[model samples]
Target: MSRTEQELRQLYASTRGMPTGAAKFAVLEEVIRHADALGLVEFAFDVRMSATSVFQHSWAPEKAFLTFSWCLAAYDREPHRFGSGHEHTLLWQFKWMAYSVYQYPEIPLQRGTDLLEDMERRYRRGGHSMHAVLQNRGEAAQFTGEVERAQAYYEEMALTRRDALSDCAGCVPSSQVQTLVALGRDEEAIRIGESAVRSGCTEQPQLIYSELLLPFVRSGLGERAVEAHRAAYRRIRDNPHHLGELALNLLFCVHSGNLVRGLDLIERHLSWLDRPRTPLTEMEFAAAAVAVLSRSQEQNGGDGGAVLRFPTVEGKRRPDTPAAELAVELRERALGIAERFDARNGNTYQSTRIRDWMDTGAIGEPLPLSVFERAANSRGGERLQRLLDQVADRTAAGDLVAAARTRAAAAELMLADEQYAEAAEAAEEAIRELDRLGLTADAAACRWVLARAYRMDGPGGSGVRALRELLDSDPWGREPQDGGPGVSPEAPQRLQPLPLLPARPELEAALGQWLGYGPEAAGWSLAAARGFAAAGREEEALAALGEALARHPDADAEPTDGVLADLLGETGAVLGRLFGEAGAPGRVGERGPTGPTGLTGLAGPADRAVSPTVVVLIAYAEHLQAIGRLEEAAERLRTACALLDAHPDTEAAGRRSTVLTDLGEVLLRLGDVAAAEEFARAALALLEPDDAWEEIVLLGKVLRARGADEELAKLLTEHGLELEDLDD
Candidate 1:
């Protein structure tokens, strides 16, 4: 081959790895250009044939028709130049063009009939069975509301033998299910849908799932309808090609009393209506949007004047449009599109479908899409009963996000009920979901509960391992995999397992800390330190202790004497510096005290004690506090404290002292002086000689409020912090 031909072949081959979308379309277009320039008809034919399928699947029906027309013209002019496989391929593509014509009302219904006639003539010339042609004729009849003619075609097609051009076994029933649904044969639609879904077709559940949504609901199968919605919507949410199916889902959402989810779906896909792939899909989508908006207005005290945000063509949301106004506009748009189809078909089928969706009533009570909401809405055993009823269904439906959360909630209930083993099992189920969705912080929190359940259950070391693993790997994986620059090159020493404590309130509090939970992170850290100390993990205990001190520098350290004795030869040197038994250099009044080590020397290894995330949180908290966002400031500090607890390696030493001091200041601003004082004291306990002067001053304010001026002055004097800085 010439270098140009070789290059063209490489370009064509490269498309196999690409996803089916506009990107692939661009690549194929370039290949076609190159082939046309080189007078390579065979290469151009193959490329256009391939491009036709891509266009068909990627929301480009017009492009599909245009590309297929070129191939058809070329084949007609010189059929002998192309391979026999091209003939079969061309015939297969004829099926797509047959039905696609109905999606465009601009194409006369006579044009559709003529295309089918040509398709039948071609198949007869090729000596092929008329199975595929007859099948599409039924579809065409249904699309035009010729039910009697459609039924006759379907019956005749059913008796015909399968051929090379026939639709796949799974797809045949899937198409019939839609027609059956349109014909109001709800029970038969459900039955065939169930069988078709079980056997699996080309689109499998995605197609049949949406087909059965209305049928399932109308047959009083509420739960199945919900499951079908969850499963099917997830598959098609990102694909604009599934606009019609999405409309079916939206109507299902409305009839099932899930107006919230329906509106959410509308917002997500509203922009697609701007340049919709087909008029049929646009009508379907607009009709669905109208239904959702109309019902939402009813729910809003029947006030159509309430404004709802809808997406613009640029993908930004604008909320100026009133609900009633937008609904009426969409209703007109849908009906207008439907009228074009009706005029072409000489029937009202398309318009009637739109009208029916607009007038549909709720088929059942509101079903909460979220497992969390369902559990929250129920009482006592009802909560458990509701969760249990749907957890299995959601899991089976492959809704991992909902399934994981549901499992986590169930595990919590089991844990509280003291059913430890079952809690562990439930937690494991949630973890599997976590693996599928990627590690969420919530999933990690759920795992923490599992660890506690194992610890409470008995003698196995499972809980210890679980907790250790939780700390070793960041669930968020936000940390650098290589532990960041300047770290040791050699493999770090393995950490010994922490002994399980009899009670682990600190562990629970640490892992459970998240947004919207009131801040108690500093207390949790101190509690964690006490637990670690009791468990005989000296390094981790000291780390936790240091973290507590960092967060609550002024708070009293528990087992202080023991930790001091254990780490240092004696408590005197560190205690003297901390308790004012000695004075420091450069103070307002005193000489430097002699000691083998200072406060900094008492901390765990520096690298092992700092977490980048904890530091960032504290820094952000500082910014939030300065901006008068006191609640957010407090929450950030609490999160930092929780991180300190979660990561025993990230201790209270050094920088964490700032976390505690900052939290104290934020709480003080929020008018909680007592809580402020606790953090101030905890922070003070961890402060080193080089600690920030402002932090010391903040601590002084907390203590001064409670009339501890003399003690605060003494504490400041020992650190050599001048009162002159406080005067400013």
Candidate 2:
């Protein structure tokens, strides 16, 4: 090795040896030179390693800014060498690029565009090139809804450059081939793209060309897509450190009939997704890799004796609801994904090899939400096609951007349809394509959509990680609207909560629980609870609601009162969300309660922690109930109950009693004698209502229990609880 390379080895050695990271990293910094040194052939590798290590350790935004500056330094010298080291320096550099574009929000638009352009020029043909510059550009084109422009840019870029590149086949001719393909010169494009890969030109351009050619090779070339997947797999499988590359190869495996192995590959990514506060880009890679692989297996080759198949019930009959019908309600928005790559429309570009891309399980249409009960007659797979023609056709056309867009569109539609798990996957593909195409803002949109979908779906393990990424996505000021930088978490909101993207309380709570943080967790939990109440996540909104209610300082039996008696109860739910919901019911009396217009909603008189979400529902419910709309009041209570049930952490007793009380009231109004009695009795058992008035309410319990007058007479006389005899 050269002198500079020698130092790099020492840098790696020094860091590897030190138990203490900072000291070791300090040595690394001293030993390795930046990109300027021609002798430092491993410059990109060392710098990337150092960048990821440093970011993991410090995570200070400034540290990242410095690292990105170092990354940019590479371009200053060997501009074409931007994606050096087979694009192995990806996570480190991609994260930096995203951060650089997203942070420093105050930078002018012209400057921002100039910076991106410069980066593209410097790093135009590698994995980093495709995933970064091209992806970002595609996003920009997409966000303005410039479908044709986006398609052209993405197809050209996706076809010409790729990750896992070789160094020998220089990309000029490949670029020419791609241009030819863009002009509809299929034979020329296919020949050049396939030849480059076939000749073992693993250069960045060739790999990109190979990816562009995958569908056609499988379709007519026969087994080329399979061979390419195997080649890609061989290059990546040994090193678990090649997490991103491994994931990509795994995606190909699913379509190539090596799906059993793809599961193992997807599983490895779970580790990354399980971490708290993972960066958005990393999250996208992991989520996409796993989701696509899973789809590939489930969607394809299962008729009769095909290798892959969806799990089916043995003896048990299907549920009244059919799976496909459920899937549509689940993947409604995903319909767009199917269309995104279709070669049928007036707007269609390529999309002929859709079958090649899809090895296939579900390319079925989504059922409308309103027909839930009657939908069991939905598409039964017994007589199913082994492959979905949708994705395969698109892939054959060499329109990767469109393929990815289809997935994203599918994810969005699925989310709208309430099919959370599948939606997250499609969104991931969309993001991957967007990132590759340089569609920064559009990528952000997809990430938020993914996060929001997972927020409701993916289990705590991967879902929370997804949300954290969305929250951490760089603002880039490149949002479709004027939403400025750092407004990432707002991705879930259609309007893009720009100008600022502070975590919603509900999201904060989920992260807090997932991350194992304390106050921050409570804060997020509180926020989420309130948001759900606003959005009617009813059962899911209760726990936060009850604590908020109990913690409010004014939760008493009020000034012989007006209409606000119901509102006092909301304090418990709100506080439950903010502080730990531990030991809450007893603490609820501390919340002030008064009569009439004066009783402000849920919050302690002294603490501003109580937000409006708590007080408003109660007031609204009670108001409506008082106006003789008992049904509305019951729904409000049910809403609170649902919120509590969904909270991961909640005081069990408090959550239970609060929900039971609402159920009791509703059942009583509906005239369900036994049901009302059971509900009330359950609440009374849990709610230790000790006061004279509460005792009177409990007396009604006795009447419901035994022969009305028999037990009541004995209890009333012994307790001296005559309503006629006692004066207030």
Q: For candidate 1, write residues 1-728 as lDDT tens digits.
A: 33398888977887876656677888898888889889999889989999999888778888889889999999999999997889999999999999798889999988899999999999999999999998899989888888777877877988999988998877777778878887889998787778767664547677889989988888888878877886676567556878889999999878889776676677657877766879888998899889888988888988773455442333255565777888899999999999998898888888998898887768867665644444443343655655665566676797656655666667777677676655665666565555446544545667677777766664434464466456544443454322331121221121111111223534533542321111233344445544554554434544544444334322122223333223222222332332233211112122234345322232222335336435434644554454466786676577666556556565746666777777888898798989998887777677664665656787777766677879878967877766665553
Q: Estimate each model's TM-score.
A: 0.53, 0.28
* TM-score, predicted candidate 1 vs. hidden true structure: 0.53
Candidate 2: list runs displaced more than 4 Å.
1-65, 68-112, 117-189, 198-206, 209-213, 239-248, 272-728
* The candidate that achieves the highest TM-score relative to the unseen native structure: 1
- Model 2 residue 404 lDDT score: 45
List, residue by residue over 321-358, the lDDT tens digit for candidate 2: 32233223323222333234232232332122222322
User: Which TM-score value belongs to model 2?
Assistant: 0.28
Candidate 1: misplaced stretches above 4 Å? 1-3, 305-322, 364-369, 373-728
Which window of ten consecutive residues has the lowest lDDT sum in model 1?
491-500
- Which lDDT value does model 2 have at 532? 58
lDDT for residue 463 in candidate 1, whole number 0-100: 66
Q: Give RMSD to native, each candidate.
A: 23.6, 24.8
